[model samples]
Target: AQSVTQPDIHITVSEGASLELRCNYSYGATPYLFWYVQSPGQGLQLLLKYFSGDTLVQGIKGFEAEFKRSQSSFNLRKPSVHWSDAAEYFCAVGHGSGNTGKLIFGQGTTLQVKP
Candidate 1:
């Protein structure tokens, strides 16, 4: 059972609000957790990744995530949600694309922001 699941299909929040996107993975060995954001007509950008070391990992664009082995979850959270944060977020796992990075996208979560 190797796959990635994002519980939230979509999320809406007012500007300057807190945000959290749930992600759970099923994999053996050390899982490589990753969070990415995509804008209109743009490619996916790496928000952050959890390979080894610290359980709590920090990412770019003022984002952070914690890897909980007990819960088998890696949830992304932001202290404040900005208008620009409104985009599609996806949780993926792996290191390569061919079959290694062979990520299993969780449908996808759309984040809407209100001014």
Candidate 2:
């Protein structure tokens, strides 16, 4: 079965610090990976995605992620953290091609920033 795992439930970082959120997935074939952010009481917004081609992908809000096929991981990273970046981050995998756009998401990682 395809699944996603976010080991860290919460992360705290000071403003201007670098941040990294881990994500791992298990699937039988090449998977479409994605990262999304959800502010408190808000809907999820796409942060980044990996479909094919380059292993490193850049995203909005100064975010980037690298797809590692060997490790089955797609970790999200930010060089500098800001208070506004504090939100719940989710890593997800899309179902194989030819199917509806259904995604299996990780538990989620909450990010907290201190000023």
* Least well predicted 10-residue stretch by lDDT in candidate 1: 95-104
Clashes of each: 1, 0
Model 1: per-residue Cα lDDT over 1-115, one tens digit each: 7888898898999999999999998877667888999998899999998888999999999999999999989999999999999999999887443464576677679999999
Best by lDDT: 2
Evaluate model 1: give its TM-score.
0.91
Off by over 4 Å in 2: none
User: lDDT of each model, Cα atoms only?
Assistant: 0.89, 0.96
lDDT of 1: 0.89
Write the residue-wise lDDT of candidate 2 on 12-95 in tens digits. 999999999999999887899999999999999999999999999999999999999999999999999999999999999995
**Clashing pairs for predicted structure model 2, backbone only:** none
